[model samples]
Target: MSRYLFALGQLVARRRWWVLAVWIVLLVGAICFAAGTGGKTNDNFTVPGTESQDAVSLLQQRMPTFSGAQMQVVFATPGLAKVTDQQVRAEIEQTMAGLQGLPQVAQVVDPFQAQAVSPDQRVALGTVQFSVSAGEVDADTLDGVDRIAGPAREAGLEVQFSGAVYPGFTADIPHTPEILGIVAAFVILLITFGAVVAAGLPIVTALVGVGIGLTGILGVAAFVDVPSAATSLALMLGLSCGIDYALFILSRHRHNIVLGMPAAESIPLAVGTAGSSVVFAAVTVIIALCGLTVAGIPFLTVMGLTAAGAVLVAMLVALTLLPALLGFAGDTVAKFISPPLHPGKAEEVARIAAYEPERTCGHAWGRFVTRFRIPLLVLGIAILAVVAIPATRMDLGLPSGATQAESSTARKAYDLVSRSFGPGFNGPLLVVTDLSHATGADAAQTLMGRLRQESNVAAVQPGGSGNGMLLIQVFPKTGPNDSATTDLVNRLRDDRDRIESGTGATYLVGGTTAANIDTSNRLAAALPVFLAVVVGLALLLLTIAFRTVLVPLSSIVGFMLSVFAALGAQVAVFQWGWGASLFHVAKAQTLSFLPIITLAIIFGLSSDYQIFVVSRIKEEHTRTADAIASVQNGVAHSARVVTAAALIMFGVFVAFTAVDNPIVKPLAFTLAVGVLFDAFIVRLTLVPAVMALIGNRMWYHPRWFARYIPDLDIEGAELERRFAHDAEVEVPQGITGVS
Candidate 1:
């Protein structure tokens, strides 16, 4: 693989301009294709085998009118004591008529006709049923709704839209986060390299790669159900990994140039070594992400594949395009970028030139940590434990409208409905009953009576029967995001025996709230399986790569700690509402997808640093035959690059929080925090400390397993050997080139 990568780098270098032009053409074509396709993203998260899905399927088949996209048009006259005024009613009626006249609107139910006025009568609720699913609703249909609501707004009445279609109307894939993240990455790169041109290369390469990947997603969305959230995630991963991969190779190439190796030699050498690590790291991430399919959820599968595609693009760009760009720059780049700082400069250059591990700050820290290995390990574990405490109480559920931004019209509608009608008015549970039998009507009536008797049931209304099936709208006392609502969903499903025996009817509880509950429960149930697959696969890969048992075991343990700490931080900020004001989030509830998504991405990303750092340690140990020295030198050699990469990823991920979407915010923040802990604490501190304590045992493996396991050569030991041999044979004695 290294030889092939080296040859590819050489080819790109020789044909730098052509290679660069090809990338440009590909990027521009992708952009044009994406724009031409212009497909909508669906945010629907449905599990096929779930009860909620089954109920939804039945509802669609039986009651087509009610099954379509439903929207609530909230009207309020804040100054008015009640909405009973004839003039106000007339204006609202006109609005309702206009809504009914819209081409996409299948039906509109006026509050006055339905007599669904609020208790205070200051608020009125009108229902609009669309002819298509919420995900299928076009922008023009939403615009038409807005146009119709203009009259009510002009009449001194507040009009707000709420429901599934609201997200569709407001959904957007913005470049602000990606642009900001790139800007932040550039600054970090500038600091790491201390050269403008050096820093710019990684940023430019990453942007190009990420641009292609993101545009590719748009193209993919034209045919498949790619959720809007998937694009954001892809963008986030693409930028971070793109920059990190390019930086890894660029850093190594620069080190070689500083050692006086020719650009041609250094470029391929860097590609063979650093580029190999990037490939291995990226594969681990891809494998981990692909493992999400084990959960058997379409949304997660799409998300994982989308992100993995982006990472793959980034890795390829690093190996191919970046090297070509580097080749084009050549000695000119060497002339501009500054050399390493003093304090045994020659020794440092020599070590880097030969790919020998050095004793830098990471080394010093490793030695210091070794002296107090037990204490450092304990402290590290304790800190993680402290942050992870909140994870135990983490609530796994999608955010309700209540958590929407205060400025959002949907939020105002949610608040208004909660204050007037009831909290449950925001998410009414649909008690769908299969009534193919002649006795179904009698069963429905008996079930309605029983539902009305329940203390938690706020109201029960017959939701009109059709096609031999009856639907009952049951409103609970709690809001959709409330635990009480989930409990109610479970309660209704569990009481199937009683309900079915008494009424001779089978009931399925489903609604926006119920769907969320079901989705969350399903994901929660699949979490263990997903974790096992991801962790187990990663362990196998790491063991194969490093040829060790303890190292992979320690790596997995550290990865979990970082993940737990990240989740804990998310729980603290989002779920516990601690410092929520900073993020402009008012409510305290974790999105159900946050943990699952975070674990998959973060675990994969963390492995990159772990493999790079550990691979260096193993290389040093092979050379020195001293575990302690290997630990110090290995950490010292790789720490700067690892830390720089982490900071770049951290900046990119943190910038994602700047996006307006609430779902993207927590995910970005969690990833940003996770990268920080994984880089600074786990990879840098705890890992080294633990390895130091373990000593040679860090490389321990079963004797039988050793014969079967092959060395991955992720560090490109063969490439290093070839480079050394070629240099010794080809270079003149007087030349001060890389040895």
Candidate 2:
């Protein structure tokens, strides 16, 4: 470790151009690399082989051998007078004729056909099935939808179109993450250091890091199934956190320079202290996120690993690229157009004499903590407890099209189909069974009868896989989140043993509901593993940094309490009707993946802030040899800066909720509340109070561990001595404000 530090010192002292050139070349190459890669399929939020997918595949396979059409288009209004009238039919026919002429379109089922409408004839619906193979959905298939939809809207009728195509293609997935990432990087740096050049440096370094990372991820995609579109979000987050850590170190380096240290000496001095914190914080976040691999869901597992990979790249970039940039920029990096706010001579005098016995610990930290400790601790706990209240009532479920904005064509189409045909019109069920024996038919018939008796079931019919398969159409009573889906799944599972025993066959239930329920169950089962990883990783890193057994444990407890509080608050907003209209989501909307997503995102973010605070406190404690004094000084110094950073971060996250997509809203909501709680409550208040109470005893470590660990000089003692020796030179007359 010391050798690496010394090597870094040499690199700075020698002013190596190769390091800067290499970074520039790699960054430029990465840009070309990304541009070279062509567009790839997006599978981030897709489940490939569920029953609906299989049904579509089977239809495509049979399309070449068989008949007219399989999908439908419906026209709806207050009434059907204009739709059923002759002029309307002529216009509709003209549109249908245009569609029929297309090479890929097989046939257009006329809505005016008597068989299409129900008894009252309030709705006139059309059916369109393409001549193309059922096995694939390509441009030709989507073009057919657009061809008819475009003309129908011009005919002045209320028309909504729903099929498997729109749900798979046209849902509004927001693109806010990119803007959020750019803005977040700027905000964190500006707030942390208060210098424009200092703020801009992190953004530049992080972009290079993320650019390299994206190139690597694109390469990895050839060997694995990566979630295509949303990978950008992970890359963005890694860049933001990574850059923040680097700036933390660089700002400290600039502070040393301002105090008269030579540039070369300040580099190692900063690296040994803040650079070390950056590495540990990055690693801890990586570990927490990567813990999602235990869940065994390929989508989540891929996301976790990819996100972790990006953070690792960010760390390396910050350490290498940032140092070189700082070495190149020198004192000019801290030169702002506006002058720094200079503290009065009395404050300077007090700071210069701060090390004296009369003032050092007794006067500085002792006076401060005695005056303010209880109030700080009380405010923190109160905020955490209050904000976290909503998490307790959290309801978890899959996202649905009905939750989309009414203006979206997909949502409008879904509503029409659901009202005109059946509630589960968009998604139906498929039951697969082994049917090699006589009992197979009997068991299948019995299951069919039970399904027919269900109130929410619209119909049951034979489907693909020959004798073993049955397609059951369920009219979901309460839409996606209704208790009916969960109830039906449980009932089927309860009856599975008897049916399987009698038929000597295995039965599997596969559908939208079943797929959602299975995913929920898997996540629930994996929660313990995820929590264990988060807590275990925090303990490992904190122990290494603090060297105390109980301090890490206490920190974990405090963090867990904060997490519970955040989750509880989420529950109240989503499950209860606290802020429904304000957030623009359904009062009862629940995201099925909330727990796992929150675990990965919130845990990492919270831990990031926690490490920043604790690192400063630990630094102060080492300097003063007094626990309470260290806690007071560290909190006072860190609180304002961290709070501002957190506020900026919170704004970036909260902005995403305004987008018109269901998936993005939950992510934004959880992240925003979590950041606020972590910034103001958990990090600012609870952590400081606990450190104050624990005091000097927090550094206690086993003698066995201490012996193996070499001492790291983060105090800048050598550089300070060198600068003091060089201070005999006269100050420049132009710089009139010298103390």
Candidate 3:
């Protein structure tokens, strides 16, 4: 793999202009294709094979009107007032009249007639049934509902629309988050490289790669059922990995230039070594992402595969485009605001661009850490364990209106309903029963009686009946994300066989609330299987890549610490509401996919940091034959670049915490902190301490395993071997060069 990369890098250097042109043309074509035939993204929440899905299918077949996108147009006033008063009722009825006339509105039920008014009569909830799903509702149609409600607003009633229809969903997601993240990344890169050209090159390459990937996603979304969130995930991963991958390789090439290696030699050497690590790291990430399918969840499968595709593109860009760009950059990437690294010294160039170590700050830290290896190891584990304690109480469930931003319209409606009706009014479970063999009234009464016996049941009322199918609506005493509601759902299902056997009726517990419960239960059941497939598979792959058992074992342990630490932070902040006021966020159930997604991505990053740092140390250990010097020299050389890349990735992810989207905020926070702990504490601190304890035995591998484990040659050993015999020369210690 390294030899192929070396040859590819040399080829790119020889054809730099052609390579640049091809990338430019490809990028342009992608832009044009997306603009010409771009498609909108829709969020698909349906979990196949669940009771909720079966109920929806039943509704679509028998009771079509009630099956479509349903929401409440809530009108609220102070407790002293009643919306049913003559004047308020008149205005609200007029507004409903206008809503009925709007496009895609199938029907509008009047609050007074439906008896949907609250006990205090201060809040009135009217139903608006749409002809199509929420995703198909035009933005103009949703806006028209708001626009036509002027009469109700004028009558002193606070009118609000509910459901996904209110958001007026659009494909034009705001670019502010991406722009902010990129700005932060550029600042960190400038500090790391200390040159405008050097810093800007990584940023440019990252933007180019992300631009192409994003456009391709948009273009393909026209023909594919791509979810809106998938694009965000793709953009985030693509940009973060692209910048870090390019930065690592460029950092290597910059040092080579400083040592007076020619551009031709330095470029290939950088690609052969650093680029190989990038590929291995990306493969691990892609594998973990693809493993999401093992959960047997469709939407999650889409998200994982989509994110993995972006990571793959970023890796390829770093390997191919970055090298070609470096060929043109030469010393310009390393020589700005200071003397150039190489001052035109081609006369006495050495054939083998050997590994040179300097006594830098990383070297000093490595020596100190290894000397106190036991204490450092204990301290790192103690910090992680302490942080992970919060994860024990973490709540994992779907987001509810109660967890929405306080100022959001969804929260307003939820609060108004809860204040007037009850908290459970925001989440009502629907029971759909088949009354084919028995009388409709008898079957409906029997099912409602069974539901009424449930401990958490607040109210059980007939929803509607049509075509031998009866709908029963049951409201819980607790909120949608409450554990009590989950228990009620389980109890209902447990009694399903007894209830149906006695009445000749078949039923399904469904609706948004019940569906969320079912989805959560499914995810809980699958989490273990997901971890086994993704983590177990990643371990085996790492074993093959490194040809060592202890290293991969250490990596998995570090991975757990990083991911759990991040989840603990999320639980404390988002779930426990600790420091919530700072972000203007509310306490709620953490996003259900947060842990799963975080684990998969972090597993990849852990592998990346482990391989990049350890492989360098292993290279020096092989060359020097002294474990202590190998640790010191390798740390001196690789630590700076590793630290810089970690920080850049951290900056990119951290910037998304400020986004208004609730789903993105927790995930961004998790990834940001996960990267920080994994890179700084796990990679830099724990890894070296363990290696110190193991001594030279850290590199040991059984002969049987060694024969099967193909050498990736990520250390550039093959490149050096080929060059050394051709023309080896010793580089004097004091030799220096400048552009």
Candidate 4:
């Protein structure tokens, strides 16, 4: 792997202009193709094989009119004695008239006819129904609806929209988060690299990679139902991972340059060594992402694959495009646009000081940790354990309107509907009962009476009955994402057998609220399977790389601590509402899939830290045969790049929280906190402390065991063996060796 990467890097550097042109053309072509034929992203939030989906399917087959997507158009004003002003009523009636003219409209239910006007006369709910599925409803239909609402808005009434078909956010990439993240990356990189071009190169390569990845997803959206969150996740992972990969290689190249190696020579050498580690890191992430299929959710599967594709592109950019750009810069890759901090020192000395951290802070910290290894290890564990306490009481659910920005229409509409009708009105349940075999004169009505008697049931209305199937709309007293609602759903299902025995009829609970319940249950069940399959397999794979049992075991332990700590932080801040105002979370609950996704993503990234840090120690230990000193030297060798990469990734993830997106915000926050704990505390503090305590026993892979596990040459040990005699250029043999 190292030899091939070395040759490939040399080829790319030699043909720098061609390599640059190819990437430019690919990015431009993707953008052009997406512009002409891109597909719109829509959320088809359903879990296949769930009872709720089955009920929906049965409804579509039997009752086509009501089964189609329905939009709730809310009209509100300051409390009025008349309930609704005559002019406001006139405006709403006009909008309904315009909606009737749309060719696809099946029916428009009038608010006055349905008596949907609140008792206060300040709020009204009207439904615009269509025959197509929510995912099939085009933007043209939505736009037409929005346009008709203009008159109502102009009539001193607030008009807001919320329903299955309405988009939660615009298609435009979240500019605030992405832009802020890039700016933060520039600052971090500038400080880390101490050179303008060096910092900019990573940002440039990362954007190109992310641009192509996102465009590809956009183009694929033309064919499939891509959730808007997929693009945001891809952007977050692609940009951060891209920069880190490039940083790893660039850091290596600078080290070589200061050590007397020519720029051209160092470029390939960097790729052969650091690029191998990048490939390892990227492959792990892709595998973990692809593992989302275990949950059997279509939207999440799309998200995982899209994110994996983006990561693959980022790795390729770091291996190929970054080297080409470095070739173009020539010796200037070693020069700083800003003056060196230690003026009057030799340029090499300043350059070395800027790029090679093992000499100063890295070594000093290494010594302190190793000297107090036991106490530091215990302290790290204690801190993470305390932070993880909130995770035990976590509450997971789908993001609701409450999770939205308070200023958004969806949020406003949600608030108005809850205040006017009831909190349960936002999440009404559709009960489908096959009452053909009714034992009594009115078994369906008897069942409805039973539902109304339940303490949680707020209202039970007739929802149309036909073909021996009775539909009942049951409204719970609690909000959609409330724990009380979840309990009520379970209680309702539990009483199904008893009701059927008395009525001689079968029934199911279905609707958006019910579907959310089913999805969360399904995700929770699959989480264990995912952990056993994906996490177990990942640990086994890491074992092959480390070629030891204890190192991999230690890594997994640290990963678990980091993940739980991060989750605990999320539960405290989001669920417990501790500092929730800072993030603008209108609701205090985490998303259902967030825990599993965080574990998968953080596990993959955790391996990167383990391999990068431990591989250096392994190399040093092999060369010097002194375990204690090797721990210090290895940490000193890799700490600078590891710290910079981790910080860059942490900042990028946090930047995504700047957007008002409900899905992206919490997901990014979890990832950012996970990275912070994993990188800074687990990898840097605990891993080293553990390694110092373990000593030589840490490298206990038997020679016989080495035969079964392939040596990936991730540290470029083979390259070192082959290039050891290159005295003129002072080629560093071991990737673990300090320049």
Estimate every model's Cα lDDT from 0 to 1. Answer: 0.81, 0.62, 0.81, 0.83
Say which candidate scores most in lDDT. 4
Residue 693, candidate 3: alpha-carbon lDDT: 83
Q: What is candidate 1's CA lDDT for residue 39?
A: 60
Question: TM-score per candidate, in order?
Answer: 0.93, 0.82, 0.93, 0.93
Which candidate, 1 or 2, would have the higher lDDT against the true structure?
1
Candidate 3 per-residue lDDT, tens place, 375-414, comes to: 9999999998888889999778987778766777788888
The reply for model 4, stretches above 4 Å from the true place, is 84-90, 167-173, 340-358, 434-444, 464-470, 500-505, 725-739
The candidate, 2 or 4, that scores higher on TM-score is: 4
Q: What value does the lDDT take at residue 543 in candidate 3?
A: 85
Model 1 residue 420 lDDT score? 88
| lDDT of each residue in 117-149, candidate 2, tens digit only | 533554566655555432234566567667666
Mark the regions of model 2 whose C-alpha exceeds 4 Å error after superposition: 1-6, 9-16, 39-41, 44-74, 82-140, 157-177, 180-188, 191-194, 215-223, 339-372, 433-447, 461-470, 497-507, 702-739
Off by over 4 Å in 1: 167-169, 336-359, 440-444, 500-505, 725-739
True-structure Cα RMSD, model 4: 3.3
Instruction: Quote the lDDT for 521 in model 4.
Output: 91
Question: Using alpha carbons, what is the TM-score of model 1?
Answer: 0.93
> What's the distance in Å from true for residue 396, model 2?
1.2
